[model samples]
Target: MLRRTLAAVAAAALAFVAPVQAQAPAAAPVEIQFWHGLPQPLGGLLEKIVSDFNASQARYKVVPTFRGSYAETMVGAVAAFRSSSAPHIVQMFEVGTGTMMAAGRAIRPVHELLASTGVNIDFADYLPPVRGYYQAADGRQMSMPFNSSTAVMFYNKDMFQRAGLDPNAPPKTWAEVEAAARKLKEAGIACPMTTSWPAWIQVEQTLAIHNQPLATQANGFRGMNAEMRLGGALMVRHMQNLVEWQRQGLFRYGGRDSAADGLFPSGECAMAFASSGLRARVMREARFQWGTAMLPYYNDVAGAPRNSIIGGASFWVMNKGPNAGETGGRSAAEWRGVAEFFRYIASPEVDAKWHQDTGYVPVRRASYELTRRAGYYAANPGADVAIESLLRGGAATDNSRGIRLGGYVEIRTIIQEEMEKAFQAGQSAQQAMQAADTRANAVLRNFERQNARAAQ
Candidate 1:
């Protein structure tokens, strides 16, 4: 009886093993981790996207992890790379392009990945300015653009009316902005004007709007041998104007980047310069009527009204760990999944929805057309200002594509410090600007040397 029972069990095992050995094995689900920096509402939105993708496909699972602010997230990604446990995808800010590109063998260029996977992604479909910033000199896209934003003017309609200014008309030039600020201040407004990201608004945008080069080598688009040229007449003059306005009480200097966005939304400031990304927050928090306008420009500059630069981030794919093998030389299945995800995010419908919800400019021209057809701009008023500003010109110059400096965060801090000393400590604008140029150039040189050694 015992022998018969053992024989029955052995036969059952043999039957199962024979079938398993003869048949093809089921493919294991590929898991890809996405590390991002968006918090709160944005973070939740990203999670929803990931959830939808997971539900739509069984072959791959995308897991998203919030890794804090942009700087913290970047540092964390670097540490993870060291441990060979980095996420497959990372959301890096625009400033980190130089650093990411410099990290050899760490990242796989987006265009190369798509091509290897046989995905037909047309880079031409992307807006010029958006593509220009993310592309290499040879016109290869290094990463995928996700959240993009340009600087714009946000004004209080109620305040404009109170000052007897036309709510429908906003200042188009620096001179007009000054005139409006003076009127608003005289009308009993405590803070007639303020701005967020002074380094970006006052310096970076200043260069782009004035059609002036911020650095010698087209704002470091060429290489790290670039030097700061922001001490030019245009930049100095603009800084001086701000200093004078601060003294006249027409302009209130707010704490560093994005901290003063709340002041404008709260009705404390009549007008403010901020990123287009602030649209959702402003719409939600602002009690009074507000309007958006193109950034003010210097009338004297030849191409005074050039397009502004972008401030948001992009998704960089890191080649690390065991998962890298899954991408292979040309995994059609995996490539299709990635291309589909990009298409979903960049599709006209999705772009329009994102724009309506977050106030970010739609990346595709078709998305803008769809939004216009839906009368979103007409219903929301100032909603069209950002798009108009972005499309004011045909194509972006090297300068208009924006700065790509290494150690850009430190450079921006140096710029902020010098400007603060000039505006708050009563230092001369020329002196402050010259000092900033020197300091920034030192940082550039240091980064160049460090990267050069890394290359060797």
Candidate 2:
């Protein structure tokens, strides 16, 4: 009789403990997939930032995955979509804007996603040059600008002084750049100047700076029927100048993509035209005093000093399932998690930290203002050059607006290939550009045909 009484008391105590346990909250985390293109050294930094975000709150967790280069990462994202495993966020290069915008059903526009949660992001709050490229004709941002950057002139201060040029007074015009390069060459420097992304910096950016057309139909902003305007008289003159520079030994080709990122920082070249993102790499690699300046432009050309174009990448939200919440019209648990994460990233504190840590321009106006108030620019001279150049015109025009041509990435390849023959002295600038135009037109026409079908 005593044993039965003891068992009943134990059962009552167990039942009481179970109710308390059931009343407590669950600590389970919502997972969101994030894929990017930064390799090794920089990838570690990305991982750290993502980790910090994940640890900041209990609402969501972001899984950071290094996909590959921008082009490769984009391909990977598309493949994932096909396989029904699309990432919550994918980093796409600026040139891919047209292609992504064309992929109608694949992505949920950022503005739309955020609006579902009753939050509206002001387009005016973004830097004009950075936002213009990603905006639709109806004036809405298609994706979130993560790492927007512009082309800038990076130079070795030591080499500048050694070449008898004032390190503080960087060349402001293409003529001045040529003069400085001549002096550096005369100083017995083997490689006076080199450039990364020759097509991007020398051709595309130069066109924009001169307020020239890259293609018809507003550089493919209007419609898919745009054709190449890169073979115009202005382009011909620019190419002729480049070919002359090559022949004069004043300019050296430093390969493509980020291959020549090392050339300037290593002190092998006095100057380079590369993306503003190279600032971080130069700081880590350069043994000499280095500085940045606005990209040199042609003084003779009308409207020659317009704002430069933006490079770098942004986070594009994939549809068909990024969040796990039940799907329909209302915001699901997954979308709320995604929006929360975006707010974390777009916050001024986070944006400023990212700008300081990397060389990329902060996309948000508030972030830029915050960074300026922190005296980051005053302390670090030349850092604000990109910002100043980007804000030059107050607003972007058809000529100064960024390139959005379909097949832009492929056209870039054709440009580089044809320009190679000119650099090697095997063909004239006119001939090289003509051939490139023919090849580029083919690509553009093909893109038109493909997208026309998609639109239909």
Candidate 3:
């Protein structure tokens, strides 16, 4: 009787535990690290996308790490490559193209990487302006365009009304912009205007919009031997104009970086020049009525207001198995996982959502059409201004296609530093451009020497 009672109790306990054992989750999938520069809400959006992708498949999990700013992230990735501890992917700003392209052993081009994994993604589906920027000279894509943006003008509608300007009619040309700025100043607006990425917005992009070149050698697309032409007549004149505006209180010098992005939303500046990607920030932070318009161009300059160049970042797959351990390459599973994640990103639905969430120019044609059909543009006036501006400019030229130069981040810094001297009255606009070009050329020359030797 004792034996029977003991056996029965043990059997009952076993039954109770069996169900729990059966319900235990399996080991998690392999994780692929993705290093990026997005912070806060943008980071949250990326994480959600990763989570969604992970849930849709059981093969891989993406681990996203927030590195510092765009420049910092690129530097860190390069360092990681040297140590053989780089992530599976890195988000590189548009300016990093030349460096990334020259990093011959540091990355596997997206087209080649996906092909290696037997995933034949259609490269033609990508929006031309966005894709063309990352493509190689031979027509192969070098990286994936993730979040491409262009310069746009943002103005406060209420402030326009207060300043007695047409709230419905933002300035279409730089001449009109100057007149409007004067009115805003007369209205007692604290800061009439400011700009983000002064060098990019005021120099390279501005040059391109006017159908002018910033550099020789096809803006560094052909080879490493390139030189800045920004010291030319047009650029000097533009800088002189800015100097005058500053004197008249029509333009406020917004720092070296994107600090001006905050001025417009804070209701301090009546107008600001910022990235189209800034719409997400403005939507969240601004409490007053605001509107976006085409980037103001000089009406007197022929071919003015050409398609603006991209400003945001792209996805670059870090070289797999840089150390290569015992294996000759990364595990096939890892390659497969990377390809799958990329496909998820390329999906039209995903791209459309990205366009709607952030005012970035859609990188896919299908994505743009989908977003339009879904009534996103109908509900959000002026949201598609970036797209329209991109289409307005017929085709990209050697000057306008995009800049591909080594040490571009440093070059931008040089331009900014020299421009600051002009603001302080230490130099004239002509002197600033001359100094900037000199400094920028030195950086480009150093890059040319390094890469030239490496090639040999």
Give candidate 2 misplaced runs (Cα > 4 Å).
1-24, 321-331
Task: Give residue 335's lDDT in candidate 1 (0 to 100).
Answer: 45
- Which candidate number maximizes lDDT? 3
**Minimal lDDT window, size 10, model 1:** 322-331
Residues 406-426, model 1: lDDT tens digits: 888898899999988998766
Which structure is stronger by lDDT: 1 or 3?
3
**Candidate 2, clashing residue pairs?**
none
Please count the clashing residue pairs in each candidate, in the order shown.
0, 0, 0
Report the lDDT tens digits of candidate 2 across residue range 159-185.
899899999999999889999999999
* Regions of model 1 farther than 4 Å from truth: 1-28, 321-340, 453-456
How good is model 2 by TM-score?
0.90
